[model samples]
Target: MFGGRALATLTRYRGGLGAAALAVAVVLLGLIEPTEYFALDQFFELRGARSPVAPIVIVSVDESSFVELNTQWPFPRAMHARLIDLIAAGRPRAIGIDLILDLPSARGERDDAALGEAVARAGNVVLAAAPADEQAGYTSLPFSYSRTTPNLPIDAVRKGAAGVGAINTPLDSDGRLRRMPRRQWTGVEWLPGFDVELHRVVTAAGLPAAPLPAVDPILINFSGPLRTFPWVSYFQVMNGTVEPTFFADKIVLVGPTSDQMHDVFATPFTRGRDQMPGVEIHANALQTYITGQPIREAPVWVSTVVAVAAALLAAALVVRLHPLRALAAVSLLWVIVTLFAYLVFVSGHAWMRGMAGTLGLVLGYGVTVVDHFVREQRERRRLAQFFSPEVLNEVVRHRREQSLSSSRRMVTVLFADIRGFTALSEKLAPEEVAEMLREYLTETTDVIFKHGGTVDKYIGDCVMALYNAPLQDPDHVLHAMQTALELQERTLKVSARWEQRLGTAIRSGIGINTGEAVVGTMGSRQRLEYTAIGDTINLGSRLEALTKEYGVAIVISEFTRRRLNADFLTRELGEVTVRGRTQPVKIYGVLPADLRKHPRAVIDVSATLTLSGAGESHPVATRDVSEGGMALAGVPEAWAVGTRVEVRCEGGQLPGPLAADAIVAWRRGDEAGITFVALDPESGPIVADYLSRRRSR
Candidate 1:
């Protein structure tokens, strides 16, 4: 059933069920980019912004320095020559000028010559270049532009600088500079990026490139947030206001650092006002490439595997655990996964998809919670069909525990079947027959429940039930007898109604036996059921079958009769060999109504009695007595039949002491016949006491 229900749920919610599919779609379609960026920021925050790499420094031409220069926006190349000389004086390993001087200075050839002389003297300098698309050709003029080529320094500066490299930092769609294009094809040849070329010129031997495809560029592992690099203002360096040894053997990058210059960009390490300037991004890139630890992203297939595994694990946890606990567990799992990804990225220089995996896990947890709630409701409704409310509650309470192992238990099993069900069905239309059977079974089941019995199951036209099992009933046999009497009385009215409609009456038979039997959830695993089985149950069934032969509506075994508490009226039905037993079993027919013509036999005995009448008591003697009634002599001859009298046996010569309320049944002259009134369960055990005394004697 659970399997079928699962299949149904899948079919009902097909195509897209829960958050699992949504999460997968999100990852596949790149819909997780924004959220993932946020998560990546959090990871960076957790890792703590790193310290800037040493051996690299920025000489920024900040607003203060720009004003201090006291020149136009594009300062005279003569001034640039002075700054280049100042930086070159430090004997740095390399000097990279991030500003582009693609054209000769309009100031005159003297200014250009001044800058070129400085660049030529500084043999370790590299000039930045930019892509310029035009008619392509090689040129000695650095300022000359060409299609599919880079605009480089003026001829004077180009002839002076050691090498040229592209200063292009590519931004992702979000406008965040996370990666750099490693190389670009100029009309002449492929050239390395600014940082790569800087590393090449500094070390004089380029590092081995990664095993990445040509189209896929290198990811930047930013060393820290903005302004992390060691720095000195252009004015400070030129004015000689700082230590001269600071730039010794270090790589220096010079660029604008003023918002007025508009050289800032967003990066992963950006926080508050900490936007990175281009020069520092190049510094970080140089450090990353030189150290040979560029951040490497795993392939898409690897991310898919991680996402699926996390999702399945999360779903299982949600199904097995309570909701709040599952949420806490999932949160912990995400934290661990994110931390692992951070460790891998930081220590191993490999980027992993932590955010995508986390999305899958959270979605799985949510879907499983919803599915569990739906499944539980379905299970409750299905179980309602098989178990009563009380039983169902107990079963649910102990569902996690195994409580239904097969074991021998003492119980009373009852079987009630419609007599001549086949014959009755033949005479009526199919629908009418169904209606009649349904009504009879419903009433019979109600009677069984009224007596606190469990309807184990219905066998076609027969209703099998149990007592003192699944729940306990101390007076189970007496309860069974009461249930049978009520069914007989109730069905008689139903039979009468049916006889009027169909010209035939309905009749039912019930048999009850009490003993030990195996009672529990039985049958194979696939078809298991809660019921009972053993000789006692078989005997109950056989007894019901024998009811038709005995011309009785209800027959109970002697085992059941012996346990009654004297309130029920029953007549002995002579023993007969049942199908499976060697010995005959004594049976009794339970009477639903009084039988005034019950057989009476002659008996002569003197019995003492105390009588209550008119709110007074008197003692009398009995002429003769039978189980049906006692004939008392010398009573008021005027006492009429149906007179209510209460009697107590103070001391008697009969089989037992008796105390009961009785009614006058018959009388003749000085003799009156009185029968004992039927007692309730709580009343004193009259018949049981008599039987006990008889057994002792």
Candidate 2:
């Protein structure tokens, strides 16, 4: 029961639950390292390649250069010095040597002196440095090392370069290079990257402050796969084959391009065997700084907010749309989020988290759609349990669009209680009592249902039913009366069987009232009940308790009595003050089922008669009267059998004048009979008084 109720509550407040689930998912994503790189990589691929910048260019030591120089793997520093001198003549903005010159040249001091002289003449050069040891932890903290691996430069070459920066390119968990940290900690101080140091050399006056390592890494928006920048062969520069103007005022990077050099790394734009050289990667970074657009990534808080907002949008759509439409809407929302991420990255150089946002959208909307279906099914089940099948059908058919909120509706309520069941239980076994009560309650409920009433609930041996709720009925009071009458008969029949079986008697008293009352399915999201409550329902229960005092099987309040037609015969039981009430309520005892006509009557005299067709009035002597009809002696022949007339009885044997609108029933010579079409409430006391006196005499 608890589980079902909780499920129902979740189903009702699905929007909140969905939002909470989405928030949890976002937190988990943020806390856990990314296991999948497909979403972010796809975004990179979607943005595709961009045009290379003009200021940054690469001077490649390609296979051609190796063959022309006729030098082994690490070419002697003489060739590099000669090539650098040839390029320095153009007065380039800056020069970045992608190779590390930590060791002396094999050709001895002459080669070292030659390279140092060329570098010193260049005046603007940045040397490459790498961490001495591998970083191994979540934060990738570096080891204690005072100098860069391969050291920055030998004393001969170190004096020429403007500054030295690390060349450590960290790969993500997916083994793909997407971002590069701008600075690193070396236990003693923070070291900037080769590209950042080059940027300082190239644009000394316009440089932004160096960013810390913990700051969000720069998204490497690669311009192309490989060799995107203008490349000149080292041999070509040394041989004076390339024009000097090619390197003038340009930030030139000299690096190996031959496949055997092993200086290539995979980038976002990498495809198949086409990877970017480490020199070009640095060049791309330098260009990004020079252009003042680094392709920033969304901060942790922004990603979190985007995820939750996506979830909320999806949830709101699911709540308002059909399941199919919701599916379509969520799919569309995912697309929109994906497109938005791409657009932001393209226009603002900021990348949003696409994977978390899309996941939140799909899951949030899907869960709520399922919840709505479950809630509707539970609502139908609850309605079916309280109402008769006929009433249930009416509710399903007519009230499908109605909201199940509590509201005031004029409904007729009936309360029935077994009179002797409490005492009889003491004389019978527990099993016998249970069986007897079940049978009695079942019969009572069936009778109520047959008269088109809703069974609100069974309180021990008492059964409460309602009319004109869950479904409206024009003749609700009549239906309640009929149910009570039938229930009385049903109880008597059951009591006779019980007397034969257990030597015990069972009787029931029922009360009915008709008036305005609050009625609807009411409860929390977890549980619901269709019932009625108000003065009408309270009076009905009160009258049912009064049945034992009045010694009657069925008692109905005057509110119900006044709404009834002339088909019923009742005894005015006077007024009694009930509990929780300020005024005395007039009540009536429903006469037993007689099947005979005019079962209620009064002995009276002095009645005024008016014929339907004739205008003449005559005084008549009254013999007996019933709510249905009255008999009179010395009636004129003008009062025909089929004629309708108005009758008024003066206060001769009654407290007040009695007036009835009636039709003629039969005529025996000068006497005519009339049947009552309706009776005014003022005459009820007069009829009761006359009947009370007749019984006395």
Best by lDDT: 2
Q: Can you give the TM-score per candidate against the true fold?
A: 0.50, 0.50
For model 1, residues 1-697, the per-residue Cα lDDT tens digits are 4455446445333322455567777878877777766766666666766776547889988887867776657877888788888878878888899988888788889998998899999888988987656754456667655567567788988788888888877877667888888777766777778877787777772323333334347777777788778878888887888555777787889898777788888998886776888988898888877666777777766666666666767876775578799889999988888778888876887778677788778777777777777877898899999999999887655543323367788888899988889987888899988898899999999999999999999988899989988887887887887788778667766876886687666778888898899998787744779899989999999999977766566788998888887677677878978888999999887654333323333333444444444665555665543444555776665455435577555344434455566665445466666766534343345444443444421
Clashing pairs in 2: none
Candidate 1 TM-score over all chains jointly: 0.50
Clashes of each: 2, 0
* Top candidate (TM-score): 2
Q: Per-residue lDDT for 1-697 in model 2, tens only?
A: 3455545445555763666466656556654226225666666678777787647778998999878878777888887887788788887888889897878887898989988888888878888776575434444456543333345578888777788887778887666776777876655677788888887787673434343324445766667667777888888888888977888878889988877888788777777898788888887777676666776766666666665766666766776678789789888777777788788877877667666677567667766667667866887889888999898887545432323467898888999988867788888999999999999999998998999999999999999999998788998898998898778667767876887798676778888888899887777645788888788888888899987776667788888899988888687878999898999989997764432243455456678888755767788877777655677877887655435578998865677888986655445566655666567888866676666666631
- How far in Å is the alpha carbon of 438 misplaced in model 1? 75
Candidate 2 weakest ten by summed lDDT: 205-214
Q: Which regions in candidate 2 have their CA more than 4 angstroms from the true location?
A: 1-10, 13-40, 134-150, 205-216, 387-697
Q: What is the lDDT of residue 657 in candidate 1?
A: 52
Candidate 1 accuracy as lDDT? 0.74
List residue ranges in candidate 1 displaced over 4 A: 1-18, 132-149, 185-189, 205-216, 379-697
Minimal lDDT window, size 10, model 1: 594-603
